[model samples]
Target: MSTETPAVRVTDLTVAYGELPVLWDIDMDVPAGKLMAIMGPNGAGKTTLIKAILGLVPPAAGRVEIHGGLYRDQRHLVGYVPQRGSVDWDFPTTVLDVVMMGRYGALGWFKRPGKRERDQALTALDKVGMADFRARQISQLSGGQQQRVFLARALVQDAQVYFMDEPFQGVDARTELAIVDLLKELRTLGRTVIVVHHDLQTVRDYFDWITLLNVRRIAGGPVDEVFTSENLKLAYGGRVEFLQRQAPCDPPPDAPDLGSYPGRIRP
Candidate 1:
C-alpha cells in the first residue's frame, strides 16, 4: 500500500433516497496525482457516489474526507464538473460568464469578480481550447464544446482534486481524445482526477486506477490488478460478456464475433 495520503477518502458511506437505498456501505481511497475512473452499470449509483463525495447529496451514513479532513473544511481544494445534462444550456449566459462562476467561492458574498478573476477564467478557457469562444453564448456551442467549457470552469478553480461526471457522454471522437489528453496533463501536474466513465474499452487506456462500483464497491485498485474478467463478472453479471470482447485475450475457437455485442453498458 502507498504510504502517501489519499486525495479523497470515503469510509463506510451509505446513501438513500427516502426508503430506497441508492448506495450501500462503501469505502474507497483515491491516491493523489492519479487518474481514476468510477464505473458501473446503469442505476449502480455512480452519480450518487460522486454527489455524496461532493456533498451535493447527503449520505445516510458514513463520512467523506479530503486529505484526511472533512470536505466542508476544504471546499476550496476541490473542483466539480457535473454532468452536462444537469445544466440548462439555453440559459442566457456567455461561456466566459459560466467559467467565472468557478471563482465564486473565492469571491465570497457581495464581492464581484474583476480583472484577476477574468484573467484566471481566460487562462482556464485557453487550457481547454475554448478561449476563442469566450464571447459566444453557451447555447450556441456544440455538445463537445459545452463539455470543454465545463472543464474550463473546473480548471479556473485551480483545485487539487477534480470530480467530473461523464464528460465523454456525447462528445465527438476528437473531443474525447482531447479530454483524455487534458486528464493526463492534470495527472502530470500532481492533481488527482476522478471521473464517472461508462466505456469499458477505454478504461484500461485512460485510467491508471479504477473503482468498480455497483451500489457498493466491488473492487478498487490499480486497473491491472482489479480490472480482471472475474471482477468485471462480479460487477456486471451477464453484461460481462460484452466486456469480454474487449479483454486482452485471444478469442476461443467457438467465441462469438465482437460485432455481435452492439449493446453497451451506459451508467
Candidate 2:
C-alpha cells in the first residue's frame, strides 16, 4: 500500500436530521492526487456524506481529517462545489464575483479581494473556458456554463482536495467533457478530488476510485476492485438489476446505460 498520508480521511462518520439516520459508521480514505467518486441511489446519504466531511452538516459521530488534521484546521486546503440546483440562479451577481468567492477562505472576510485576486479569478475562468463571461450576470448563463463557473471558483481556491456534488447533472455533453478534462488536469497537479457522482457507465471512465453508498458504504476503493456486480446488488438491491447486468467490473470501450440515471463523461 502507498505509505503517503491520505488527502482526506473519515472515521465512523454518522449524520442525521433530528432522529433520521443518514450515514452509519462510515470510514473512508482518499489517497492524495487520486480522482474518486461517491455514488448511491437518490437520498442515500451521498450528499450527506460530503456535507459531513465539509462540516456543513454536523456529524452525529466520528471525525474527518484532511491531510491528517481536523476539517476546521484544514479548511484552506479544501474546496467545494455544491449541487447546481441548490443555488438560487436568479440572484444578482456577476460571474467574476462568483469565482472570487473561492478565495474568501484564504482571505479573511474583513479584507476585500484586490487586483491579484481578480487576475486569479480570471485565470480560473479561462481554465474552464468561461473567461469571456466574467462580466455577465450569473443568472443569464446556461446550466452547463454555470457549472463550469462553479468549477472555476473551486479551481481558484488552489485547493489540494475538492468535493463536488452532482456536477454532471443537466450539463451538456461538451461541458461534461470539459469538466472531466479539467478534473484530469487537477489530478496531474497532484490534487485529490472527491465527486458525488451517479452514472455507473462513467464510473470507470471518469474516476480511478469510487464509493458505493445506500445510506451506508457498500463498497469503496479502486473502481475495478469494489465496483462489482455483487456490491451493486448489495447497495442498490433489486433497484439496479439494469446496472448489475455488467456492473462495470471490466471496462468496455462503450458505456452502457443504467436505468433512469443517464449521461456519461466519455473518455
Candidate 3:
C-alpha cells in the first residue's frame, strides 16, 4: 500500500445553513486507488460533505485538501456526479453535448471543443456503455441511461479522484451493477472513487473503505475494521433491525422443536 498523501483529506470541517449546522468537526482521509462509501441516514450531511470537499459549498470552518493541496489548486483533478434528481431533464441537450461539458474545465474560459475533445468524450461514453446514445437527447433517456451519461461526462474529465452523490438512486439493477463494476475498474486504474451510498446490505460488497456519518464522524476505516454492529448502531440508531434479522444464532434449547409439531411441515 502507498504511504503517500491521501487522495482526499478533510480536517475540522463544519458546514451550516443559516444558523442550522449540517456537519460538525468532520475529519476524513481517503486513500488513493480505493472505492469508498460515505454512508448516513437522510439529512446526515452526506451531500454537504461532498460539496464542501469539492468547494461547491463553502465550509463555515475547517480545511479540505485534494492530493495534499487546496481544492482550487487541483480542481481539474476532481470529478463530481451530483444526485440524479438535482438536474433538469427537460434541457434540450444531446448526450454527447452533455459529456463534452466535462472537457470545459480543461478548455478554460470560452474555447469551443475541438476534435480531440470530441474523441475523448466518445471514448468516455464507450467506457460506460453509452456510446450508441451519444446523439440522443438527455430528456429522452431513461433514468439509468441518464446516469451513465453523467458518469461518462465525469470519465472524460479524466480526474484523479471522483465523487458521486447517490449515483444508484432510481437506477435499475443492471445499472447499479454496472456502476459498481465501473467504480472497481477506476480503482484498478489508480483513481480514487467516493460514493454517497445508502444501502447498508451492499456496503461490504461494494466498498473497501467506509465512513459512517450522522452530523459527525461515527467511524471510518477499512470495511472489515469499521463496519461493525456497534459502529452501525451509532450511525443508524434504531434502524439497525435489518442487521438483527440477518444475524444467525441458535434458538433456545428449551424451545419446542418445530420439526416434531404436527402443524409444522418440512420443505
What tens-digit string does per-residue lDDT give for candidate 2 at 1-267? 458889999999999899999999999999999999998777789999999999999999999999999999999999999999998988889999999999988898799998989999999999999999999999999999999999999999999999999999889879998999999999999999999987877777799998889888899999889888778777767544334345455544454542326333221
For model 1, name the residue pairs that clash: none
Candidate achieving the largest lDDT: 1
Distance (Å) between predicted and true CA of 215, model 2?
Answer: 1.2
Candidates' C-alpha lDDT: 0.89, 0.88, 0.87
- Tens digits of per-residue lDDT, candidate 3, 94-208, equal 9999999999999999799999999999999999999999999899999999999999999989999999999998898799899999999999999999999977667777899
Cα-based TM-score, every candidate = 0.92, 0.91, 0.90
Decreasing lDDT order of the candidates: 1, 2, 3
RMSD of 3: 7.3
Rank list by TM-score = 1, 2, 3
Model 3: which ten-residue window has the lowest total lDDT? 258-267
- Give the clashing pairs for model 2: none
Error of 1 at 13 (Å): 0.4
* Model 2: CA > 4 A from native: 239-267
Alpha-carbon RMSD of each model: 3.0, 3.9, 7.3
Evaluate residue 97 in candidate 3 and report its C-alpha lDDT on the 0 to 100 scale: 93
**Residue-level lDDT for 208 in candidate 2:** 95
Give the lDDT of residue 176 in candidate 1: 90
